[model samples]
Target: MEPSNDIKGLIRQSPPVDVSKPYDASTLKGKTIVITGGANGLGSFMVREWASHGANIIVGDVDDTAGEQLVASLTAQYPDSAFAFQHCDVTDWDSQVSLFEMAVNVSPHGGIDIVVPNAGIILPDASIQFEEPVLKNGRLPKPNTKQFDVNITGATYTTHLALYWLPQSGSSPRDRCLLLVGSLASLCPFPTQTMYTMSKHAILGLFRTLRSTAFRNGVRVNMITPYYVSKSNMLKLPVEAAFLSGTAGGATIEDVIDAATRLIADEDIAGRALCIGPKLKSAGVHGVEDEDDLMAVQERENNGQGRAVWECYAGDYDNVDAFVKRYILLLNAAERVKGWFGIVTDIWSMLRRK
Candidate 1:
């Protein structure tokens, strides 16, 4: 898919932030934050911020040396508070689960207050800048296996493990969150950073799916797609590194940091991207209009008896509208059949077992 125009449009529309007031840190007090990839970059920064605000922290990272050092520093600083570190490979489900279990063991009174699945890496070919590349411009060297393992699979595993290990999935009013570290790539096309972009976009979709599927379970999921977190692997190139590189301008490390913090504070926002930059208010991400429109269409269909389906199958509607209606009808019919089949299968299986 040609990502040039799409990425350009998204970057032009930066994340919108409410800079009317500074973020309140009091909300984090007494909370327990579990951060994957807590050793460095934005994840580490978040850990420190949460810890300073009286939140207990469980730092999970593959870099044991750096991770342990951060923990030691926090432990010394917050002698009265709780802080610990665990060596974890976020790509591995078992390792992520172990991290969650460890967090629970440490904080029995409170389950994981918030989970930040922030571990990610840039593609290998994209990792090297264009100073004197052996390969031609615009074309990356090769596929990056490490990027896929760490960015895509790693982020997915971390989120699921957090939900599984933590006692946050319920109908209670308790505040529990799963924040995925998505990228601007998730919103639009990123030409060269194939693996990185693929992973990020997939993570965004995963978060959205989990949000709807786990709504009854009370597992709130969200994502933050910073344009270019400074001094990090997310953006090793200059601002004009790629064709859609204009979005990198004016974005700094501080911008991404503030944006992430603001995301955590804004409880009303979810299932949307937040393009963070140096200033809090300058951030502008996509809204829920598309999703809302789709939902509204579905509700209309379900409210009226399969008429929407008939209209769709009749093929008299406009292209987009007809496609949507037909898709919804097919989905509804499939769901009905599946539900009945499930009931019958369950009964048969029970009888056989007996």
Candidate 2:
């Protein structure tokens, strides 16, 4: 049974997605996807893959040069699909609003099907600096909060905008998804990086909190927690210096893409998380890994094939006590009634300002 009367999660979760199983890439055809921080690296790679599968892709990023170059490259190769780039600084709310507005304007389907909040950065040992400030002129200067703002605030804005716009999934019906990019730091402690770990934990928290409720908008909310040095060694982040670099058994893009596509194309899935890490030899996959390694915590798929993607926190929000059930029902009711008066007041305020 579902956890509540409505806006509830699944009663059960199937095994980790069988990437070998053929999925209908045809489902992606005619759909439109919006990705933030998509100028390079994982975002750029995903753009190429989705565009090749006949999806309209709108990239939002601060890097105009890389964004335009990516769009140009894809437009040339995939003439059938549409590609557009909008310069977006995710930390700025207005900038992100403009990006989404542009997506709606250019979308062939007149709606967004998928959104990836993929823009993130790592400040080498930033936490230690902030916590233990050095005396400059006998006074500590204001610490930089750029990392927290971009990773947390920007992503929060993206999620809020996604909730507002995605409920109206165009004129005709199609799948709606919010694909969140989290990190291994979300599940395990990063002894060296405190701030980064905190931000990822918040992302994981956001996914957990939204998944059960976001379903009310017919949006499937999913997250991917990838290991450091994942895919082409995460060229964007300085993970190479963070350890766990090449041949250190980080996840391949193939597995990340597979897990992502499965969560997206498979409409039945909602409110789930996937961890992408190294594909280890079955013999060594268990005992060989550190206890804290997220990869070691999972059961391998049948046939003992070396694989990456693993399901995180198998609880699907299905088990609920009566008090919890009633609480959720009340919460839904409150949300249904929320913001209307505030929205009206805001509109009037805007009109008066004009």
Candidate 3:
């Protein structure tokens, strides 16, 4: 897709990532991060990784026992890092509000630098066959939408809170980011998992829309769309069957973590989506005539390794509508107007009042 006219300069395709290169994970030190559904699976792993880097982490999850254990482990491993766990039911607004409040209260800076709306659910019996039972007495029964409530509604609540709190975070604008967790289902069709598919698709839509405008809030928004990972309970029999039938294997937890780490560590990266799947040799740059030739060149330039993480939808921001272009232009103009003169005028006004 062509770059949107308004975001022409602001948005560009992400450069090919070199996973083998070393990154100073310490760059995340002292930042306050809040994550929902962080008791197990990917969320739990992220908590450990971020804490190891010295980030103050607040995890909210419904699993009290697991969440407490995770927090205790991290606290013991990194005594210098602040770690807390709060009981949260993402489907409820009050619960989520309390979770955010707790995060701020425990934060070393009293503000949140990052928010991960990672809470999601997929019921084994979520499909229409189980949820949409036959009508009784000519009246249709209510279908179960718990999947929607947790995945879509919960994510929406988290996003709303992030927008309200992230700007107020003491951290610089470059540090303020929202990392959303989507699924391969967001892009592909899941025939039997109707609710799960719908919820993920909704998240994809949310990510795309926010990426186009999140810059206005100085919050970088990115997404991770992982193919089925064998570790999660959400990956039911149907998912496994599909994977077995296909030539490709399922993704691994390490692969997902690798992708997540890249997004979290790179401050300049914004409005990008990373898809994590089975590991494969790096394709090298998109039009290289010889794989061996490209690999040799890449090795000389920067030692490279095979990668499972690939960028998707990197150009959605380019070529936007006229309204967006005008809006961006106005913002740029306003910034330019608020130069040194604006600062001086504010100082003079304060002196006169004094």
Q: Count the backbone clashes (under 3 Å) in each candidate.
A: 8, 0, 7
Relative to the true structure, candidate 3 reaches a TM of: 0.78
The digit string of per-residue lDDT tens for model 2 on 10-35 reads: 42333445444677776888888999
**Per-prediction TM-score to the true structure, in the order listed:** 0.67, 0.79, 0.78
Find the candidate with the highest lDDT and give its number.
3
lDDT of each: 0.62, 0.76, 0.79
lDDT of candidate 2 vs native? 0.76
**Relative to the unseen true structure, what is the Cα RMSD of model 3?**
8.8
Total clashes for model 1: 8
What residue pairs are clashing in model 1? 14-284, 15-283, 15-284, 15-285, 16-283, 16-284, 255-277, 255-278
Cα lDDT tens digits, model 1, 1-354, are: 722212212112222334334768667776677888889877888888777878888989989999999999998998767888999988788888888888877763557777888888875465344223465586656533687788878887877776675455333345666777777777676666666777778877776556444444555565677666556544445543652354434355655665566656555544444555433221122443344221122223323321110000111111233344465586674443223224447667999994
Candidate 1, poorest ten consecutive residues by summed lDDT: 306-315
Looking at model 1, residue 324 earns an lDDT score of 42
- Ranking the candidates on lDDT from highest down gives 3, 2, 1
Give, for candidate 2, the lowest lDDT window spanning 10 residues.
5-14
